[model samples]
Target: MELSVVVVNYNVRYFLEQCLVSVFAAIKGIEGEVWVVDNASTDGSVEMVKLKFPQVKLISNQTNLGFSKANNQAIKLAKGRYTLLLNPDTVVQEDTFRECINFMDTHPDAGGLTVKMIDGKGRYLPESKRGFPSPWASFCKIFGLTSLFPKSKLFAHYYLGHLDKNATHEIEIMPGAFMFLRSEVLKQVGLLDEQFFMYGEDIDLSYRILQHGYKNYYYPKCQIIHYKGESTKKGSLNYVIVFYKAMILFAQKHFSKQKQNHFVTMIKLAVAIRATASIIKRLIIKVWLPVTDFALMFLGAYLLIPWWEQFRHGVTNIYPRDILYALIGFYLLTWIMSLWLYGAYDKPQNLKSGAKGILYGTIAILVVYSILPQNFRFSRAIILILSAWSSLSITLNRILASTFIEGLLKWNARKKSVCFIGTASELKGSEELLIQAGFHRNNITHLLPEEVLDEHQRAKKEIIADAIKYKNISEIIFGTEGIPMTSIIHAMMYLSEFDIDFKIALHGGDSIVGSSSVEAQGELYTLEVIPLAKPVARRQKRIFDILSSALIIVLFPILWIFLVKPLMVFKSALQVFKGEKTWIGYNHPNISKQNSVLKPSVYLYSKWGKGLTSTVGLDFYYAQHFSITLEVSELIRNIFKTQD
Candidate 1:
């Protein structure tokens, strides 16, 4: 074979499927065989390969072997000149394989080549190439000095910022997204070091290739879209611990003795410093600032009253300089107290927005100024100006600080991953809700159960084992409804063994309390209520009649008064014109002791004329009282009923 692609998959079945599909579609004419080494995926990953692409070779493990060992297992069976370690979450363009193969074929000195990888949203991933992590590089990266001094050559050397993305060049390390390696280079350097498990293995392998006098090229001629963090995007604490532990192992393997010791010492010192800083911050926020503000306010009142009294008569009593000094001292004291009381120096995370900060600060100043002795004749104008300045200053300070703090928090939090557990439908619902609520989809991993002889018991065990194995499930939610109580209990009990925290769906009549509940299909939960205190019948008719009449009057006032009335009059006149007479009359009849009904009656008279002759005849009928009003009332009532 000319090339062999090794993909190590673990519980990313859907992404893996898409990846394989893209690879096969892209490499149709390329000379290669695709090998998938599945690390015991319980999400039908192995079955998918068997059913859909039987021609491809698959190695299914009984348990999840780490990434390096799994890939090595496939590498042992590969018979190719070059071996490409590809992530299952990545999609290759049609030219990717051909381009990489051609590059390596032309450049005999190159040991490995990596293509430019864009994420799903078409943003370039910066981790494509990096300098080897030496003691200085590690320190710069850990302390965020590289980002702080991004344009400085000495500081950004680790990130290789000098290298342009549009050009191919030799680099110390390439990400494992699409690492195309020469089989001969691997034979000389040995397979990937499995001791580091997931993360550091790729770095170790790339460094080893460079150490053996082979160049690693960052080839941008071809491209692949990396979904990024598909496998390890959950269980923040576990991910951190595992990743750092792997880094330590890598450090032990590669770093010089002195550098290694210094790195370890630096890490320990950093932790201690962080803890002390946190304690100091708490003390200042909780105790020192509040006590200091109280003291300053008292001093301001004591000194301000005497000074103000001395200058109460006129500025001539004291020198101009003395009066100015007193005014400045009083203003400084007020400013200090206001700043402290408003939590100006508090942690950025605790800071409120401009409006809230101003509101609180204003209230504090008002109380402080009011309770001071009446002898202190403070100028109202000075107080107003200082208060406005203080509000603006404090609010702007908080806004700037919060922006910086939030950015840092988000950057640090991005490395974390979370695993979700539930059926497909339940997980989809949960995912939609979480996405709407601002949780990134890349951080979510679904833990699915495998088929077994005893499905219920096996499912419970599988879920528990997956949680333990992945060790990154920050929160487990039972999203499925109508699950047996026993199953729920089993799941909860299983999760509790790992000291995992979880939430369950809230059912009928059950209050969620601290938990959140999302709206489900066909499930109605009242969010608000509008009380219909009065009888629905009367309220509906009155509202309808008022609204309808108002709209009609506004839209057609002239038509109602002139055109409609004149039409009726013309009809009456036309009867006279035709030699027939008509009369419009009203009659009142008492229906009950308190109620009377009015009815309108029309009578027609037959006429005799030159062209038309008619005998005198009359038809009389009593119109039903309350008929129009009753019809209108019924229509309004039905409208309200339909709305309900």
Candidate 2:
């Protein structure tokens, strides 16, 4: 056999499926067999492999056998002249396998090879061609000298800076994502050292290949897309700990005790320095908005309100600085925490998320305020004004920043560019929905009617691939209505060459389901991340309803004479305040005959608390959107319309 492809999979079933699709297409002319060794994935990957690609061999492990050990399991049984260790989260181009095989066939000296690779975002991974991570190289990498001086051979040598990324060259390390090996060399140098679990085994194998008198080449004639493993988070303490321990293990196994001690010291110092920087950067990013808002609130409050004053020497006792500090800290923490609970920073950094974050944050702060002691309390009115102003400021800041980055800096304001491919009927109204859903205005879309994309006479994959190539579309969304799943998957396989994204638009409203590039759990779709999906209910939904209702009950009683008509109109709303009914919904208890029609906004949804008034069936729009501002607007309109 020419090749034996070994893919070690752990839970990334969708990615694995796509990778296999690409791999099958890649190894067309070669005599090859694919082996999938699953590490006990509960994501139906085993079934998918068994059902979809029946020809391929599969090894099922009950527990997670780490990458090195899993690959060795297949290596022991591999029959091909060459064994290819491949990551499940990768897509090989059609030429990738052929070129690598041809290169190895020509170069008798080359025992191991890795081709050029890019991430899902199309960024060339420097890890694709790296130095041996010698003490100096590792130092440069950990301290970010590699990025700081990318062109300088000394500082940037960790990524082999002197060599061009597009050129084939001798390299010391090969990423486990795509390690092509000669079977004879593997037998000589031995299988990957299983002692070093996941991260360092590749390094150990690469180093041992050289010790056994073989050269490893970074062949750039072909390229593949690797979604890049993300087991450890960057700049996290756990990342530093896990990764450094791996480094120490490598040093102890290979280097002298004195060198190992030095390596350990270097690793510790680097981890400490980098982790501290990571923490500070995170804190600055997280607290900047709340801190600024706090400052503005303090300024606004001091300017607007004044307590009793003493005329002696024209001076009054100032509010204690310690108390003011305490108040500011309390408010800042509450507001920031509330925004976090509201998912303000989820992604696509838009008006709606910010508006909703502040709205939910305000409600949270109110809850906190009610629970605080009299001595801790300050201006509630100022807080209300602060919430409104903060929302406006935060939104304005995001708009300006996004505009500057997109317009001036020529960066996409939002990273994911979507292509809405739909049937003619589905296309008519979806563009506006997608645009409003935070996709760039210039996003490409294709309308191939059912007749055009019929199974018997389906549009060629070349046509779809060309469109994707031209638009540089990052995400492909199929209208789930008329399009068959087989066609969708077929089209996906055809255009799988690009390091891009895929999603499916649900039929009814604006909801779209898609795969997550960040996670190994495949084919999981969440409205929280995808702005195109329906608005998610706030975590503070019940609290806001209950609190808003209580305030209305208290204030309405005092102003009942003036608000007689409103009170009569708000009788149902009053019931909401009393907890007898909800602040928004579809069902009415008493008024079964007169079903008043309420116009739809994004926020109207049946699952939400019943409001004072809404159009008939309008509450079901929670399936589309739900926002505090949208709710308030409808409530005002409903009240005034009753008088009319």
Candidate 3:
């Protein structure tokens, strides 16, 4: 065979289908063969390939063996003079293969090549060509100097930004997304280093191609659209750590003896920086806005006292900031805890979540105030004023922070003007679903499939540009059957100049869904996180349940006489020991297993043992928003809000 195409896929079946369709079209006249090596994807990618493209060779691994190893499996058996490692989340232009082959054929010294690439939004991806990550180049990139001076030779070498996109050039790196290499070159340079689980293996392979006397070229004659982050999200902490660790592996292998320490140090610093940024982002989104509520509550509590004294006792001896300040802090902390337990501060906030969170907080304050000694108590007049101020401030902050996030940057906001793009038929109930999912109903608009593909590329670009300018569409949703990946990619490329977000709506016929999660179809939205089923996470919950339940049994002595005997506490504990029940879990244990916020299915809650006394729908709430921090918050609530 003249050409062999190798695709490594992990759970992106829809994108893989579109990619194969484009690949089949690209390799038309040539003696070409395709190999798809699936990395044990549960997204039905293996089944799709077997059913739809059986002509292609398929290798199915039982577990994720990393990107390098998966590609090596297919590369070892490839029979073509040239092998192309293509990402599943990409659409190749019709001329991509032919142009690459012709260029390689003409350049007798070309060992490997990569064509120009664009992201889903259609802008040229700088990773299409790159210089080796020497210490200096890595530093510039890690510190973001490369982005600051894209066209400058000194700072922009990471992307080889010195080169023009319109011209072919001898570059140092070709992305794994579109690595077209000579079969003979593999015999000389060896395969991708399996030590790299995902990130730096491409850089390692590219450097080896150069070390072995083969030249790598960046050809811009044809392009493919890379639907970036479909396989792995760049925003994830795991991705960040793994990526930087890959850099360290590269530095150890390739850096000079004298400069190895420098490169290693740079890699470590980069990892630290990325990890810190990820943590800060999570803290701001999850805790920062809620903290403001606490601060305002304290302020309201302090100010209301003087206002009450002036009216009731006609004594304006203003209390010192220290007077009952500690108690006020404790009381407000309980209220905020109540907010967290009541499912307040959930992302993608709906109108009611904010109101309910504040309501819970107010009730908590009232409960605490009613039980306080005279020395600790503030007057009822002060309590009412504090409640009003705290409720209004917290509610307004939640609304403005979520909806007008960009304008204020005061809180974590995801308010977006969404453009639903699909065929008119496919879009029938999409609008209603999106509204229920908490997108602004008024901000939601439609962009038909015809408008994106009715004309040529130039015309499509014009139409999309005009729409983004006039309608201010911040997010673009692709409907299944309503929009093909190719069309979605095309729209992204055409609207590349515009700042917008792209998402694939998984509108499957599955009936499972959470409050704002997957139900009928599953949307693989951009950077959408899928919870990994780790047995350790479940074990932690078991440990916590066992410890907390034992403590409660011992501490609450009255429970031993009246409640423990009648309610069969020992029997429940036996069931828990036998794995039939959990100390804390869903309202029902034997229900269907669910794992996503998108559907109401057992998703996250099903992992734990069920509890004897459930706290409202907290199990289901945690099921929607799973995190160590949120888990701790739920545990705290279970301690205070117990029912026999």
Candidate 4:
């Protein structure tokens, strides 16, 4: 065989489907065999492969075998002269395989080859041509010197950034996303080291290939799109730890004793620093808005307290210091908590939720005001004024942040401008998919093949340029069915200068996948609607949980006379209240464990039957059509049957 393509997939079913589509297209007439090693993907990746690509060699692992072990599994079974370790999140061009094979055939000394890779956004990934991560290179990369001096040979040696990206060059390392290796080289040097689990296996193997007097080439002619970090989250502390730890393992396996120790220590230090930074960054992103909102609201209310005392009582500091501070603090806490529960901070630039949350909080504050002692009571008009201030201030804050801030808080409140490039049928299909995926369809523009192609059927650059100028298109989506992989690659390369987010829509699939940057996780917009995935639905469900749990706790005392296990009922309520469990959740442990959005339940049942399968069905039904009434009815039906 000419080539054997091995893709190790885990839970990225949609991406895997698109990747396989491209792979099959690329190897249309070639002597190539494809293998997919699915590492216990609960997202139906195995089933999808079985149904769609029956010709593929499939190995379904019962558990998640890390990157190295999984790739090794397929490499051992590969029969082709060349073995390509392909990521499930990547899309290869039609001429990619042919061009790569030709190159490998000509360059007999080439042990491995990797091509130029652009991210989902069509941004050239610098790691496509990297120097071997020596101590100085690693240090430069870890300490941000590589990024600071990107084109410098001394500091940017990690990525070999001074090298031209459009030309083929001999490189020391190949990215795991698209590593094309000669079968002979693999047989001589051995399969990927299972010790360096995820990140550094490519570096280790590349270094070994070099040591064995073979060259690794970075061929830029055959470009592919890598929607990076689909299988794993890149923005997590675990990613930092795993990546650096893999580097340390590589050091232990390959480096000399003194260099190994030095590398290990440096890696550990880098891990500690990066992990800590990740944690802090995450914490800031999570709480920055809420904290800022609280602080501003508190300041407004605090200032209002002194003004109210002066204006109404004709005396400054009339209220007691303890009561004054305590009341203000309590009121602010109540408002913030209510806003949080109502999901004001959930959606970016969603001022409507914040306004709704403020209104609800005002009502709550009034309710609490009526119940409090006369001495603790403050001005009702002051509360009204403070609420108005909060509403205005919060809205202004969001508008300013979204306008000025570059990342995280920067969100376009306006409908996104999308341009779909494909056939008429694919354009219509993509529109429907976009609507199902919750994209605004108002500003959508369709660029048909005929409109975008010349008399010779060559893609016209001015077509996209005109669309961007006229429509202010921010996102461009290409359909694989209507456009060839070669055309997609050409479009991406030509339009790389534009500020457009590029997404790929699989011809017959429900998902549109993209990533804004190389460091970002791949974003999938699919038709598989989980009701609980909505912020509003989640907020309502949480409200239902809290109110129902509180009522259950309150009624437990009265039910003690008729109940067989009154204490158990009380305990369940407590658990639900504390978020340790849920009143109505997924019945099956497996479904519940994999992004089910429901906590483990105190009771499991359905209107259908008492069987285990029935219970699991009920869970799916609940997730799809989650409503307060459904949960309440379920709670009522299964309240007495809790022991079951």
**Of the candidates numbered 2 and 4, which has the greater lDDT value?**
4
RMSD of each candidate? Answer: 28.4, 11.6, 8.3, 5.0
Best by lDDT: 4
Report the alpha-carbon TM-score of model 4 versus the true structure.
0.85
lDDT of 4: 0.82
After TM-score superposition, what is the CA distance of residue 476 in candidate 2 from its true location, in Å?
8.3
As a whole number from 0 to 100, the lDDT of residue 21 in candidate 3 is: 74
lDDT for each candidate structure? 0.57, 0.67, 0.68, 0.82
Q: What lDDT tens digits, residue by residue, belong to model 4 across residues 123-237?
A: 8889899998999999999999999999999999999999999999999999999999999999999899888768888999999999999999999999999888787887679
lDDT of 3 by residue, 1-644 (tens): 89999999997776787678779878889899999999988656777677778898999999999899999999999999999999987778667888889999999899999988776555778889999988999899989999999987899999999889879899998898999999999988999899998989889999999998889999987777776777777667887888888988888888787798888877888888888998888777667777788777777866777777787888865545575577667667766765654445544334555556567667777787788777666556665676668778777777667653422221222366777766665455555445434466777777776776655432365766776788887766666454444455556666656756555553442111111111112233211121212232354455555665566556545544444242455555445554555544444432112222121221133223444245324343444345555555544443343433
Q: lDDT at 202 for candidate 2?
A: 88
List ranges where model 2 is wrong by over 4 Å: 40-51, 229-235, 290-295, 306-338, 345-349, 360-384, 396-443, 447-644
- What TM-score does candidate 3 reach? 0.70
- Candidate 4 residue 530 Cα shift, in angstroms, is 7.3
Q: Judged by TM-score, which candidate is best? A: 4
Candidate 1, which ten residues in sequence have the lowest lDDT sum?
524-533
Q: Candidate 1 versus the native: TM-score? A: 0.45
For lDDT, candidate 3 versus 4, the one ahead is 4
